[model samples]
Target: MRLLHHSTSTDRPFHLDPAPLVRWVYVGRFSIATAIFVAAVLVWQDALTDTGKLLVASLAFAATLAVTAVSVVYSEFYGRALGPTFHYLQSVFDLFLVTAVVHVTGASSSQFAALYILVIATSSLLLPVGGGLLVAALGNVLYVADALWSVETPFTATVWVQLAVFAAVALGSAWLSAKLREAGKGTEAVLAHVRLQAADILYNIRSGIITVDATGRLLYANPMAEQLLGLDLDPYVGRPVLEALRRIAPELVDAVDRSMRDRVRTARAEGVISAIGRRFPIGVTTTYTEGDGRNTDRTTTAIFQDISDQKRIETLRLRAERLEGVAELSASLAHEIKNPLASIRSACEQLSRSTFTGADERTLTHLVMRESDRLSRLLTEFLDFARVRVARREPIDVAELAAGAVRLALAHPDRPADVSVVCEAPHGEFIVEGDDDLLHRALFNLLLNAVQVSSEGGEVRVEVEDASVKQLDVGPNFADGGVALSVVDTGPGIAPEIRDRLFDPFFTTKPGGSGLGLAVVHRATDVHRGHVFLDTGPTGTRFTIVLPRAARTMPRFTLGTSSATVLT
Candidate 1:
């Protein structure tokens, strides 16, 4: 059956699917038929004993069964191929069924004639706008003819009143069903828009999201989930994913299991996962919902994100607070001991050169003076660490400063024999707002250390560049736009055990070393509102100084000919 070719003001074809209404109608028809058949056979067997009437009743039952079966088969296989034709056919079947009931039970006087009202109301819902009216007209004709054919020539008042009631119901039912169909169309449009909006949000959210059914079968996993987990999760959908989840993150597995088995909800919980050979922490939350209050029909959802960078920033903040305390103490202690230490060194030197001193005495005095000098030198380095300050703030070209430091470090006496050096800096000025002296000293210390650590004939690289957001992820949070000056060395890497203590004052492994080189570098960077990062392992070590940029910059100064001075 086909729907009427119709359109709205927009010229778009408009039709409502009547399949749902048809199903409800079938259920109601079956119930009424069952009740009538049972009453005739058991409750009113004597009244229903006429041979011909019994045959009609038997035939009606079979026909009702046949029509319902055919409708079910057609609905499943043919679908909407016949459209309103199917609706019209069902309306006609119900009309005949109702007419037979009225005829067998004494025409217009039978209360079963009211079944015509149900048929008319249901037809209005299942048929298109005007199809309802068309069906009502035919029903009215059939009812009037049945009443007149089964009775005497004179028309009765009861029959006339019944016909008037039928007409009124047909008009009212058609009008009411038309309004309901319009409301249904508007509701479907709103629901479709909501579904699309929710789908967009679920797919594009930053955090990973996953859903699983009560049977532990995976239902949905967003794109971010696969990206964060570094796994092909799509293949596991509709299959059990606990095994895969357990391998990458056992903590998440426990959360989902608890939700599915015990209806537990995990909120603001933390877990750890290792992906791409790097271990990082993840924050997780899990919630489960039961379908229709069923214990077995549960669904669990888990949301999680990798929080490695967040954790690092927190650690850095705590570490900075501790180091600030140490710096204050270092400055005070250095000031208190400096004058007395100077007097002791002077007294030893005077005794060593006195005429009355014996040869052995002179040797001992000289040794004392030399030892004092060495102590004095170490103290001077401590003062440098304590005195890390920005003497002048300017938009200095860091590329120029790094190139100069690389040159001075290459010529230093401490550099390993035949060790080569490479310096990479962008053309023109790469500027940051900081004291030239402090930044230069920090850059020089890193370069000197790198060159000193290199094996004979190994390479040391000095690189300078503008820091981007990606690089700043591991740096201090205070730095916005910045410059990165890095010194890399090819040599035996630092031991993992002592890596944490590398910046601690007097923490050293080298003989006759002050251990204040990195501490000085750290202090200098910290004072400039920047940070230093040390990457060291079995391969080698790299020290990077990330200094925040000035409020503005320009290609104003070129290297080698400007008033800018590089300090070591």
Candidate 2:
């Protein structure tokens, strides 16, 4: 079967949606008839002289009913030509009906004459500017003719006054209604423009944006979000956010819930999401908006991006940096090995001479053995620095970690008894996510350096502070959260010249140092996505490691023997 389609003019500029106008038109017609019938009843109860007025009222009601039925039929059936033409026809009929009723009752003095204003206002709203003015003029003509041809009242000064008043009301109402219609059209146009611009931006922007209501129901999502999230989101509006995102990223769903439950104003983090049977990196940021007034209606807006490409680029950049470092380290290693090999070769040659005494032979042998051990230690340090990785990450207590590191540093046989090691941390539990053994070795290196550098009887302090309350320059990336672990020592500060190479592999001031301690600390902190900061002054030197917190809160894990791995 073929279906018929009807076009509407309401889509054109300066026209309104006709559905509401049609409804109001029906209501107005019915209400006017009811008012007229009641007025006639009161006149009849008073035993009025003119029975003709009652007849006119009955006729008006019938006419109004007939017109209302015709308009409704045209709107429902024909559908076409249901615009200004229908509205103007209704206005013309109302003018004549109202005039007939007024003439039959009392032309100049009829109370029902005031109903002209209602007709004028409604007609003006429904019609265009010129069409409404035309309607008003026609109603005025009908009213004036009624007053002039009235048989019950003379056309005296009173009639002229009534005519003038009616004309003024009609014209004034028409002007006002026209202005109102223009304003409505202007508002509709502005709203349409804004909506179009908003849609354009939402679709074109690169970042994926999703807006969820207070109950975690999805309200709106742009095309970018659908593409990046790998979901057909057109039909997902009003669905639960978890229902859509659970398969792809349960962790992101949990993050959104946490933001709502905790009432956090803003949060940011990076995670891996599984979508389309593949896992990739994503960076998520949530902004919470609170509703005004007593009944709280909060909205959470989450903006995210597929960062897999960016992460791939970062990996390549880091690999390039490591390759460049390896080249430099190889040169440094060759220079270092040449000196040790030369010392050992010289010692061997001396021992091979027959003129050498027995004591001399023993000294040469001892020199060769020392140089060989030194070479072995250097190679081990290089391996440790190159192999640093954070494989198993878990939450660890800050205080216990600090304590273990300090104990290990103090327990060293070569440690000076005069130097004291202390761990200062808040009484509250502070658990941070990181590789357990890696962090321990990192902290141990910092504490050991502090102890070795401090003068006899000097104090070496390991301080752990929550970054949420304290001052640290980790930048906006970690501004939302983090903890700082710092090792401070009371000793002569590092010289400016040597400070630049403090963390350089194979560069150290100590006589027998392999110089990989600070480098290992640097690598370990980097693996946990943390930063290292160093402050050296005339008083002392301080080394700080700042690490961000994890989403899950795990119990404290004390450092056991397994945690004390030598980076070298």
Candidate 3:
């Protein structure tokens, strides 16, 4: 591959150094010099030894070596200190060397005469336009002068043919060089544009991408990678960053290392990242590319993304499926048992009212009826969870709902007297389109749960936020505009082992808990195309309900028909 150097000077906005190619030219020149001297000594030794032609050949060989040594040192070590003139000098030196070879072998009939064409073509590519033709004319003069001055040299048509060939080759190669140079500039422009586009895409994407070479040098890290990993990666670029990467995202570093070691690609793999004491799931993918023999380096690229929302959505989807099936079965069982339960209660009541009833018989019948009443209440909760749906799409003010729910939840008999509830709704009206009754019930359930879990004198805060107006880390699932209702409590948080089952029907932690509250919350939000998020730790538990798309106007509670009570 050819490397380009950008020039800043207006006199030469661009410069292409032919030093690499020139080095190759030196090799070819040395090989030709060696072959010519060897043939003169081994093949034509006696014929020219006494005539002094062999001595001339020896001097020519010595001059070739001396000129080449100086050219290599000047071009390679000095590094374009003399600019294009340095290249011009090399081309002229090559022409003179070829002329000496033509003189020693045979002036007009020399087989080594074609060496002049080689020098002409090399100078055409190495120098600017007209440089090749300039060298070509000088070579013709040297060749003709040698032929005229030599005693044994014969003037022939071959001399004229050789000169014509040199001129034609010079013109054709120079034109080709000019075209190639123009194409290179156009290609460089296109490459620069493509590089900008790729960089923009990498930095702006939601996922994190990192590229690392086999020796642990960080090749690239995009902006999202820096944010997700919670580190400033710009300074570590083109340097070893594996030590820094290991603290927060060791899994990501390992993925790249495995790819580099195995020379393979991994797709849709699982990884984890932690920052600021919060660890979350991330989906990882990795791939490796082996460098060409010219460069001994292998690169591995790792791409990962925070998948908390995806995992939450998947869990909710699975829980919904399980609850729906359970709800249907519960409804069927309740319907079949309700009829017989009522008959049994009726028979026990009738038996108690008869004259034959003793005190023991009346007590048993009362106990039977009370137990039946409790089971009936439990069945009703099951039906409510199963039948959750958005009965009306009306713009109901959520801030009003939260205030009402907070008041009622705080007043419940289950709440401790000293435990306080604070409702904070920032905007005047945070409106969402859903069944007002369902939204209210779900909001109340979350608040009541928080209140119940709080210690005496602890705080339970209910906040209503318009996510469109606020920047919140609600994950990608709820990235769109929403009205987020958060119920936070200062209680011992829910356990990780039980978090997955928090929304399952009849799953509870209390002594006499009927665990359909969170189930109803999940089902209600699902029907409204919203999401319910649960974040619990040792400090406290936070339950967030995000209802997608807050409404612009209230359809059910219009100002003309009725005055909407934003707060009471």
RMSD values for the candidates in order, in angstroms, are 20.9, 9.8, 20.1
In candidate 1, what are the lDDT values of residues 1-568, reduced to their tens digit? 0011212322223356666777887887777666666666767666466655456556667788999988888886665454778778888888887776676666777788788877877777667658887887778877887788775333568777777777787788778777876776676666656755766787798888888877777778888888778888867877878888888887777767755665554334567887777777887778878788653367888999888888899789878976886786576556545655776666666676665558756665666676677677877887788788888887788878877887888788898769988899867557787888888888887788778778878999988876644444443232224676878899898887887777766667778777778778878888786777667778778777777666434222212221211121
Best candidate (score: TM-score): 2
Task: Give the per-residue lDDT of model 3 (tens digit) for 1-568.
Answer: 0002232322332335676778888898787778777877888866355456676667767877897888888877766454668778888878877887788778888888999998888888877777778988898888888888778877778889999999998998889888887876676676667766766687689988888877787777777888788888877776788988888887677667656765664333566788986889888878788888322268888888999999999999989977887786577566656775776776677676676547867666776777677677777887898789888888778888888888888678988889899999875657778899998899888888888888878999998876532212233223224676889999999877888778766778987667789888888887877777676778788887777655233112111221111110
Whole-model lDDT, model 2: 0.74
Question: lDDT per model, in order?
Answer: 0.72, 0.74, 0.74
Superposed model 3: Cα runs more than 4 Å off: 1-27, 47-93, 137-164, 183-192, 203-208, 213-218, 221-244, 262-266, 270-283, 287-298, 305-568
Candidate 2 is scored at a TM of 0.64
**Which scores greater on lDDT, model 1 or model 2?**
2
Instruction: Give the range of the ten consecutive residues with the poorest summed lDDT in model 2.
Output: 559-568
Clash pairs (backbone) in predicted model 2: none
TM-score of every model?
Answer: 0.45, 0.64, 0.47
True lDDT of residue 395, candidate 2: 82
